[model samples]
Target: MSSSTSSSEPTAAWARFLRLLLLFAAVPAAIAYAFIALVDPWGMLPLSLPLRRETVTTNQRFSYPMIAQDPRFDSVVVGTSTSRLLRPAQLDELFGARFANLSMNSGTAWEQAQLLALFTRRHPAPRVVMVGLDKEWCESGPLRRLTPRPFPEWMYGGNPWRGYGEILNPFAAEEAGKQALAMLRLARPRYGRDGYADFLPNDARYDAARAAQSLVPPPAAPAAADPAFEFPQHALLAERLAALPAVTRAVLFFVPYHVSLQPRPGTLDEQRMEACRAAITRIAKARPGTALADFMIPSPITREDTHYWDPQHYRIGIAERLARGLAAAAEGHPSAEGDYVLLVPPVGH
Candidate 1:
């Protein structure tokens, strides 16, 4: 009986230790997860504590979907980093609708299409749907149309419960703390509540020498045209635009690539790009309120090295100019400046 009692005591002690271990580990973990869930930095949780959530995270793939679904924004700016410079407030002023620039850095055609579909479904009678046309739209043949940054497809669903657990990670916790701190004005916001951010380097930090290096293109003789060249993603763009309500004015523009990066006038490169543009123009033509602003040509915007930060992204002043130009194009104003061609004019015009 004594031996049995002694053995049973050890078993009970071991069980107690196990319980303590679990308590120490589980309690803190649960608290951490609860903190993250309640703060809901991504705004993907139902338990979100109604924090005035400005974008606190740099991962736009995770942050911007909430902005896309925001009812305050009836219109959305969709594109890659090329479109990030377009300010939503300015766009709202220009287009007379609330705007959210939901452009993702290196955002693929697939991601853009998905997010756009999400926005059109969430909003009612969206005013102006502007898409910054990128080279990826002309991407031909067997493209998976994905980028290295993981788009949170899980967040776009109707059920918030499915995505709540995803925010329990350390990164999400850190962002949650930042989100809280942002509320207190202790942490700086990465993006505006309307999803606009000046992600480019400050004008004070402008390094022309370094900028020059990024502008230089590799040795390029015009490419030989393949009979198989196709703009597969144009169909995807059309489908997303189709999903928008008939009243939504769609503006599609080819983002200005640097002249060196743009195709030579008579080259096969030019042939392929123009072919893609023609198809895109046709898509825009079918939709009455849609307009196509063609900026992917060798003009002042593309040729002037001082105007651009790199081959793809332009300076802030230039971005604002483009915004105003887009507004003008939307109003059916002809490009008298010879900068861009308004391919498919707006409906009333």
Candidate 2:
């Protein structure tokens, strides 16, 4: 009886050992498969490759290294693609300070505010944050189209690991995966050498060339005064502006839109625009160190569709003018000198 019992015990132990081995092996395999599927390795993976000759041919000149290398940027331009025309180099030249354009396509006020918070956490708070405001940004709607895919949070929020990778291998696996997916989704254009050049013009000569052709026009008055319009983002703008660190100087610029597209009487556009302007005015007046440079007036260049890539965004030439104006505004204002923390007032008053 004792011998029979011992044999049965050995057999049971063997079966239990096998089950444990299988469980461990299955876990890793499942995890790997899930990562590959969500990352869509083959389809969106290639965008992670660093700047190569072949890759540069098609893309204008977008290099992650270019942004990562410039840590001394004391001035940052924030906004959607409409503000893309303002080159960091020009601002540096004009202000005798380092600057970088952190603008992205279809960027919203909320996104900009988030980015500002992120920027402050890492590098020294920029002396001047040139925030580009447009009527579209004031629209009260979810920014569904601007949603970026889930990436390492640090990618946008300034995580050290991602920041290191961004500097070392700007075309790392994750970025490539995100860019690839963006391409498949038709969200962003494929990368090429010219990609950077296309957006970041090498010189101001293009503006001169376009101006000589009689393509640009003089500045005109505001399209119309529709006071009933409400700026949907008023509360949000005030909140974010107030939250900025006291030391960082904030300057708001109202980007010009085509007069032809101005909202008609009693239309949603007019109402929204009016609300945004009023909200902006209120914030500008109340904030101790904050100021506004309203440049929404129609310009000769703005009148031409060619001057703008779309209804709201201006061409690179127009962007240069905006940059110059921003520089002038910054220089003209003495209030920008000291550190000022932007605090949110109590909800009711």
Model 1 CA deviation exceeding 4 Å by range: 1-6, 204-210, 265-268
| Residue lDDT tens for model 2, 25-130 | 8897566444433443222222333322222112112232234224556767667766766777777788676766666566656666555555554455566667
The global C-alpha lDDT for each of the candidates, from Candidate 1 onward, is 0.84, 0.54
Best model number under TM-score: 1
Listed per candidate, the RMSD to the true structure in angstroms reads 2.1, 10.7
The TM-scores, one per candidate, come to: 0.92, 0.58
Candidate topping lDDT: 1
Model 1 per-residue lDDT tens digits across residues 1-349? 9999998998999999999999999999999988888888888777778768868889888888788888888888999899999998898888889999999898888888888887887885788899999777877666556777766778876777987757767788898899899888899888888888888889888888888888876464565756447777878888887777778888999998888788776576677787888889899988778889998888878888888888998999989989988999988887777679889998844
Model 2 scores a C-alpha lDDT of 0.54
Give the poorly placed runs of model 2, Cα more than 4 Å off. Answer: 1-70, 141-197, 200-232, 245-247, 332-349
